[model samples]
Target: MDTKKPYLAIILIQSIYAGMFLLSKAAFDGGMNSFVFVFYRQAAATIFLVPLALFVEWKSLPPLSFVTFCKVFLLSLFGITLSLDINGVALVYTSATLGAATTNCLPVITFFLALLLGMEALRLKTSAGIAKLTGILTCMAGVLTLAFFKGPHFKLFCLHHSHTADTAAASSSLTWVKGCFLMLTSVTFWALWLVLQGPVLKSYPSKLLFTALQCFLTSFQSFGIAIALVRDPYEWRLGWNVRLVAVAYCGVVVTGVTYYLQSWVIEKKGPVFLAMSTPLNLVFTMLCSAFLLCEFTSLGSVVGGLLLIIGLYSVLWGKTKEQRLLNEKCVSTGVNKQGTELTVVTT
Candidate 1:
């Protein structure tokens, strides 16, 4: 329950997620179909996590109640399948950095959803809450700035094809705008999934098992949809090339390993601290894109990214300070022993 450790862990996770975005973009640039990419990503994530869940939660795993199964299926639908599908599609139309920058607004979306659903109290009068609200708004502004403003572009590969309606949509000048909007929708679905699963997480209390179930369920759902919606293998564009590596990395490392790390961090620190790590993703993405993917940055993008990170840090700092004070006060009052306090902090 060392407060600082959670911050570090979250930063690490964010870096992984950001790198995943760049990798995803590369796969798209190679003409990989979004649906097929998601299908494979989920398939790989499921493969990686299934054995881990079996080993860890084997004895403790409860029999799958119909209700529990349905909830998990729904979580898979919104959080896993839909989010990945939309994000993958959107990335084909947008720059990697812009696609990732939009995700910085997820925390704000989650907070508002919590308030609307009565999961959290609207303590507008409190300085801590006010600071958090301001931070969220500022971060959102940064995301919008990145989306609407074309900072600069150094095109390395100018891809063109026989123009069709789909190609037209994908190659539209406002690709960033559409991508940002789609990413926002993905965030909304992801946030709602988190909110809906609060009770499930409490009841299950096994992150690995939940993650496995989610991936497995979502893979099947996505697979079914892919079969129905995508009739041509030519459209799938599956290639055993660099795009294959990108897909594998996203599936195994990004989805599988990152989820485990994120669950562990949340178990140790709490969701707010975990969420604060999101800005670090931007940093990692920028670095990886520039170095690994040969992406060039523009002045406006740099400023917008800095503003997003600053706003994100402000919110996390405020939350950490408030939590630390509460913990100290509890200790002073002997409300709980160090052991109990640690557990509370971990949660």
Candidate 2:
């Protein structure tokens, strides 16, 4: 019922993503296999979600049909398995900075997919529409700047024995082009999940149940991948270590909570809103790393972060404006006319 609720969700989601970067990095530093880590993450998420879904959404759960089950399976495959797998591989071949830049394009991909699938409208004729589209581009530009350009060093709390100049150099394998392509592929899979889940959630309508099922299916899917890649039992062993901590944090906070929040947001605000929220992850990451890791930012980061915030707000205003116009139209028409016979958005 609130037009502003998605913003709150976006804030929380981005914070979680930022924290994920730090925690995932620690997990990797501790020599955790990415595949095994993913499997454990989904497995733990499933364990947590099962009881919650069973109890919380039990009454609301719809009968799972064959077609719906297939859809959910595809969702799990793309959303969890394929996207994370490709992302990990991409990181191996490319720098983490490049990977973040690649992910920054989520708004662009999600917006276009939403328009193509008729889930979101391209009201280019209106200022609000143009602002929304341009904002996505602007946000991408900001991220690109932050990723590629480091003007001058700037820091708020980074004085502990470290080189400031080399901060942009995120550790990665040097297969640049291959890594970029893989990263793009992962982004595509992620966007596919974002676009398709809106429709699936409409049909199924049980956020908790579907999310839990997706986690369960993803756990198995990840396990299969892990089996093919990881033969060492030591990698899979979750003892008292940072690897265990990462799994717990990622599973409970990132996947379990973040996925459910995103689903609920898509159901409420549409995928465009969810997609447009990605830039904030960079903002949060910048702040988190600066304080936590004593990492310093550059002039490019300062400029780009400002642009990112502006673009994000512009997009939000555009989307909200469209809703207002649609509401007005509905009131004038005295019927649910589906925004002038266009089902591109539903309130």
TM-score of each: 0.82, 0.76
The models' CA-based lDDT, in order, is: 0.74, 0.74
Best by TM-score: 1
Q: Candidate 2, 117: how far from true, in Å?
A: 1.9
The 10 consecutive residues of candidate 2 with the worst lDDT sum are 164-173
Report residue 105 deviation for candidate 2 (angstroms): 4.4
Report the lDDT tens digits of candidate 2 across residue range 276-301: 67767776776666665555566765
Question: In candidate 1, what are the lDDT values of residues 1-347, reduced to their tens digit?
Answer: 57677667777678778878877877776677788878888888889889988998899986677888788888889887898888877777766776677677676677678879897654567777787788778877776776676555443332333222134234555775787788778878887887788888866777778888888898898888777888997866656786778778887888776776787887886777677667677777766666566655555566667767767776666667677878899877785576688998999
lDDT of 1 at 164: 22
Stretches of candidate 1 off by over 4 Å are 1-12, 152-173, 264-273, 328-347
Clashes of 1: 0
